[model samples]
Target: MEPIRAAIVGTGNIARIHADSLRGLGDGVRLVGAVDVDVDRLSAFCDRYDVPARHPDLTSLLEKEQPDLVHICTPPGTHHDLALACLEAGSNVLVEKPPALSLAEFDNLIEAERKHGAALATVFQHRFGTGAIRLRAMLDSGVLGRPLLAICHTTWFRNQAYFDVEWRGRWDTEGGGPTMGHGIHQMDLLCAILGDWTEVSAVARQQARRMDTEDLSMAHVSFAGGAAASVVNSMLSIREESYLRFDFERATVELTHLYGYGDDDWRITPAPEFADEVMGAWHSGASGVRSAHRAQFAEVLRSLRTGTPAPVTSTESRRTMQLVAGVYASAFTRSAVRPDELSTDSPFYRKMEGNGPRW
Candidate 1:
């Protein structure tokens, strides 16, 4: 099979991971080209990754290499236009998460993708991790039974220096606070595992940070199956202990990672009655950041070749974005908001209006 050709935009920290995945995969992928606004940094990234081709911007990159797919690793704010441009140019796109600043912008991107008949995927690669896989299997096999409750705690410290980047702390650029930024992966996985959420009520604050956006937030969500959940997201905590727990009628399943998503280091404690089943289902759910990212890349290749859909599609990503908007809406209204109630006319869905967070 021919290796899929890929070009990556944005040479920031995360892009290096994508580039390295392409490099380490050895034969499954081809690092065709790269694009970034910073010439020096772009050059350095290409040299480091051994990618021979580079473009100054998306336009030239599309016109030049015309890669089969473009990975939009740029900031969240840049996703809408970049994804549209690539799709219009007849290229598939795999954009990093928090797909767009607003739900409307995401709709625009989706429309463009459909009109152009292009493949569009969002990078929620944490869904492909070994731990995630095992958890999903348990949920599917009824070993955990119907979940009664769940909790996702994503607490990581981010100092002022971390948001020193011009676009880092702003709502117009980076989108939202810890909830949308740091906690999104776990939130996405929560929704992925437990099914859709019906309503959300949240409270947020800028406590302990100079950023204009909320550095801390707590949201209570109700899933379709009447399973309730609480998600606590923060960048103000002194110590970070990330965890996701699901309480099922038959058993309780818990997954914890020290830093965040894609961490294989996990622990699942089943209820005493279901202990045997849990033990029988146990597999080494070992993984690292690289492994999850690589699995998604390979899936992208399979989708391109077989015309099969990517595991994480744009619509699924939009639902995750809707959850993000719901968090903001719930915070602003001081009440619970249905996830689907945040439509095009909702205040939270208005793009380019919210002030970006400040350091």
Candidate 2:
């Protein structure tokens, strides 16, 4: 099979992950070009990665390089426009998490994808880990019975300097606090495994930062399966720990990636009562972050090759964005917000609203 040519946008922190994944794709993929408005950053990225061409903007990149895929590594707020542009250019797109600022923007991207007949997907590579895949499979197969409750405890250390970037803390730029920005992976995993949430009540704070948005957030979500969940996400902390624990009717499953991004580091434990059920479905040993990213990239390439379906479709991404908007609205109103209950009048439903709540 011919290599899938890829152009990347944004030369920031996470762009390295995309570049590394492309390099690891061997002949399955090639890094065709990179685009960024910041010429200095764009030049630095191309030189560092030895990419052939660096375009001043997406329009030029799409016209000149004409990559088969556009990997959007830009911030959440830029996803809708960039994705639409890529789809219009007849290139498939793989955008980073929190697909867009709101469910509406996400819907716009979805429409654009459909109109262009392009494959548009959200990047939630964390869900591709061995541990996560096993857990999802077990749950899907009813080996663990029905999940009763879930706890996603994700805490990390990011000081003020981390938000010192020009657009880090603003809702217009980066979206919400940890819940929308940092903990989105866990949220994605939660939705992937447990299904859509019915409603949510949340509280948010900016206790440790000078940013315009909250640095901490807590939400209680009720899933459609009658399984309740509590999510605690924050960047204000000393020791960092990222964990996902699910309690099922037959057994309890837990996986933790607190140490950072890697598969061998996860721990999966099942309840003693359901030992047989869990053991029968046991599967572990993931390659690592690079491998997971590569796995998703390969899936995207396959979708483009066969004109089939991408693993994480635009509709799925819109659901994720809806959940994100629900979290932000829950925190904003100090009330419960339903997953499908966004009003046209809701501020979160409105596009380009100002920065989220402040401390």
Candidate 3:
């Protein structure tokens, strides 16, 4: 098969992940071109990656190299426009998380994807990790039985200096703090595991960070499958951890890691009556893969090759992003918000801040 012609849009830290992941895929993918507004950074990135061409913006890169896929690693605020442009040009796009600034923006991109012949996918790498894959399989197979309760916590510290990067923490740019920028990874995985959510009642606080957005958010989410999850997204913790716990009728599963997790990070405890079978299944579950950009990029390639939509399709991601926006909407409105309430007429659908944050 011919290598996939790929391009990176940003030269910042996350873009490095995209570039490296693309390189790791070997002959199946090619780093055809790259783009960045900053000339020096772009040149340095292209030079380091040995990219064939570099352009000032997406338009130039699209017009020249005509990459088969464009990875938008730019700021959350810029994702919609860049992704829209790529899709409009008949190029598939795999954009970084928070795929858009708001549900409105996300929906627009969805429309563009349907209108154009190209595809659009969101980056929710945690869902692709082998551990998550195995767990989902078990749940689907009824080995774990029905999910009862779960906890999804992404507690990591980012000092004030980290937010000084101009686009780091703001309602308009970063899109609403830890819940959007940092914890969305774990949260997306949570949604992927539990399926659709029914309602959300959340509270957000500015906490320790001095920014235009909250540094912490807490919420209770009820899922359609009769499961409830307690979620917390915070950047104020000193001893940071990304933790998730799921309790099933037969067993309890837990994963603990700061960012990406491997098989060793997962633990399962089975109810006495079902202990033998559950442990045997857990022991035989898939292993030897860590959750990261490369793990997901491989899946993206497979889907493209098979002529199917990529993993974490926009519809799947919209639910996760709905939970994010729900957190903001519920916190600001001081009421429980349902997924249906985030419709066209809803303020939260129009903007994540939803008529600005409560504070």
Candidate 4:
């Protein structure tokens, strides 16, 4: 089979991960081209990745390579337009998280995908991890019993200097703070495991940061599956950790890791009566894969090969994005936000801040 041709836009820090992950796929995919507005960075990235073609912009790259996939590693502000360009050109897109500045922008890309017969996938790598896979399997098979309560936290530090960059902290640029940007990864995984969320009530604070968006956000989310969760996305923690605890009727499954997790990062404690069944199910779960760009990329390539939508499909990611918007809506409005309320007519759908961030 011919290897799928892939290209990347935005030669920044995260773009390197996309390049490396694509390269790591070896014979399954080819790094055919690259694009960046910055000449120096483009030159460096292409040279480092040994990309065969380099273009000044998306149009040129699409016209030249016509890559099977384009990874949008640009900032949240540019994700919508760039991914739209790829989808319009009949190229699949694997975009970085917070996929768009608003649900409005994301739905635009979704519409373009339908119109163009292309796929739009968000880079929610955490969902592809072995532990997450195992847990979901058990949940589906009733091995884990009913999911009752949960906690998802992304607590990592970002000092004031981190937001000093021109686009780092603005609503129009980076969207909201930790909730939409940093913590969305874990939140995506949470959604993956718990299924669709129904409502969110939350609070956000600019806290210690001087940015226009919140530095800390806390939300209580209710899932349609009769499960409720407490979520915390913060850039204010000194001791960083990404922790999620899912308390099922039969067991409590906890995942503790910083950025990614190996199987060892997960721990399960089963109720005494269901001990054997829960332990057996957990032991038979997915293994040997860490949650990373590579793990998710492998699945993405497999889907493309099979002529199917990729792992983190537009629908799934949009639901997760809506959850992010829900957090912001609940915070800014001082009211609970539900999935149905975030429509095209809703201000929160057009901008995460709704009217504006209260802070």
Candidate 5:
């Protein structure tokens, strides 16, 4: 089989991880070219990965190399335009998380995907881990019964120096702060397990960081499956942890880890009557895989080969993004926000800070 020709745009930190993940795929994919405005960073990244061609920008890269897939590893503000361009150029796209700055921009990218007939996927790698997969499988099999409650918290520390980077914490650039940036991963995984979220009431505060976006956001979400989740995203914690807990009728499953998870990071406690069956299912299901870019890339490559929609499709990503928009909307407007409330006409749909944040 001919390898999928791949290219990386924006040769920065996350781009390096994307290149490494693609390289790890071996014969399934090939790194054909790379592009970045910074010549020094681009050159260094190309040399490290042994990438053969380096282009000055996305236009020239698309016109010249014509790669089969393009990875958008740029900042949050740049994702919508880059992904749209890649789709228009007849290439599949794997974009990093918080796919776009707002629901409007994300919808535009979805439209481009339909008009151009290319797959558009977001890099929500947390969903690809075996622990997540096993939990999902068990839930689907009815062993866990109905989900009741969940707690998704991403409390990590980022000193003032961390936001010193130009695009670190701004509404126009990085979108919102921890809620949109750091917590979206756990929130996405939360949505993955609980299914559709129906309503959300949230509050965002600048707190410590002196940026336009909030340093912390706390929300209460109601899912369509009758599950309620309390989500907290903060960049002010001295001790960091990414924790998620789900309470179901039969069992309670919890994942505690900073960045990624192994089997040991997950714990399951079942109700007395269903303990044996729940434990058996959890033990025998998916195992050994850690949540990382490589696991997701493997599935993306397989979907490409099979000509099916890729994982974390724009449709799937919209749910998570909607929850994000809901948070900001509820926070800014001082009321509970429903999924239907975030229409194209809504301010939150256009920008994460609806009608400008109060604080």
Candidate 6:
């Protein structure tokens, strides 16, 4: 098979990870081009990755190289426009998380994808890990029994200097604080495991950070499958941890890690009566792969080659983004927000702050 022609936009920290993952794919993919408005960063990234072509901007790159896949590593606010442009250019897009600044923007991207007949995927790399994959399989197969409760926590410390980057804390740019930017990964993973959420009641606080968005947000989400989850997204914690726990009828599964997790990070404690069965299934399940960009990129490339929708498709991403919006809406309005409540007319649908954060 011919290599998928791929290019990277936005030569920042995350872009390097994308470039490295693409390069690691060996012959299955080709880094044909790269683009960034900053000439120096673009040149340096291209030099480091041995990219054959470099453009001053995305439009020039798309017009010239016509890559089959475009990795969007730009800021949250720019994702909508860049992704639409890439899809219009007949390229599949793999946008970094918080796929768009708002639910409306995400829906617009969804429309663009359908209109262009090209795939649009978001970078929710957490779902690609073997551990997550195995856990999901077990749940689906009834080995884990019914999920009754879950705790999704993404607590990481980002100093005030971290928000000094101009786009880090604003609603119009970075979107919401930890809820939209930091915790969306865990939240997406939670959705992947538990399925659709029905309602959310949340509270957001500016707390310690001197930023426009909240430094911390907490929500209680009810799922359609009779499962409930407590989610906490915070940037003010001193000792950071990304922790998730799911209590099932047969077992209690827990994952404790900071940024990412491997097989070792997972732990299962089955009920005494079902311990043997749960252990047997857990021991025989998928293992070895860790959560990272490379795992997700491999799947993305495979989907592209097979003419299938890629992982974390826009539709799936919209669900996760909707949960994020739900948290914000519930917090700001001081009421429980349901899935049906957030349409184009909803304030949270357009901007995460929802008519400016009350906090």
Evaluate all candidate structures by whole-model CA lDDT and list the values in order.
0.81, 0.79, 0.92, 0.93, 0.94, 0.94
Report the candidate with higher TM-score, 1 versus 5: 5
Candidate with the larger lDDT of 1 and 6: 6
Where in model 3 is the C-alpha error above 4 Å? none
Per-residue CA lDDT of candidate 5, range 160-191, in tens?
99998899898999888999999999999999
Model 4 reaches what TM-score against the true structure?
Answer: 0.99
Under the 3 Å rule for N, CA and C atoms, how many clashes does model 2 have? 1
lDDT of 4 by residue, 1-359 (tens): 99999999999999999988888888989999989999999999999989989899999999989999999988888998999999999999999988899989988998999999999999999988899999999999998889999999999999999999999989999988999889999999999999999999999998898989999999999999999999999999999999999999999999999999999999999999999999988887789999999999999999999998898999999889999999999999899988999998899999999999876
**Clash totals, every prediction:** 6, 1, 0, 0, 0, 0
Candidate 1 all-Cα RMSD:
2.6
Candidate 1: what lDDT?
0.81
Which ten residues in a row are the worst by lDDT in model 4? 280-289
Q: What's each prediction's TM-score?
A: 0.93, 0.92, 0.99, 0.99, 0.99, 0.99
The candidate 3 region of ten consecutive residues with least summed lDDT is 350-359
Question: After best superposition, candidate 1 residue 69: deviation in angstroms?
Answer: 1.2
Q: What RMSD value applies to candidate 5?
A: 0.8
Off by over 4 Å in 2: 259-263, 283-291, 351-359
RMSD vs true structure, all candidates: 2.6, 2.5, 0.8, 0.8, 0.8, 0.7
TM-score of 3: 0.99
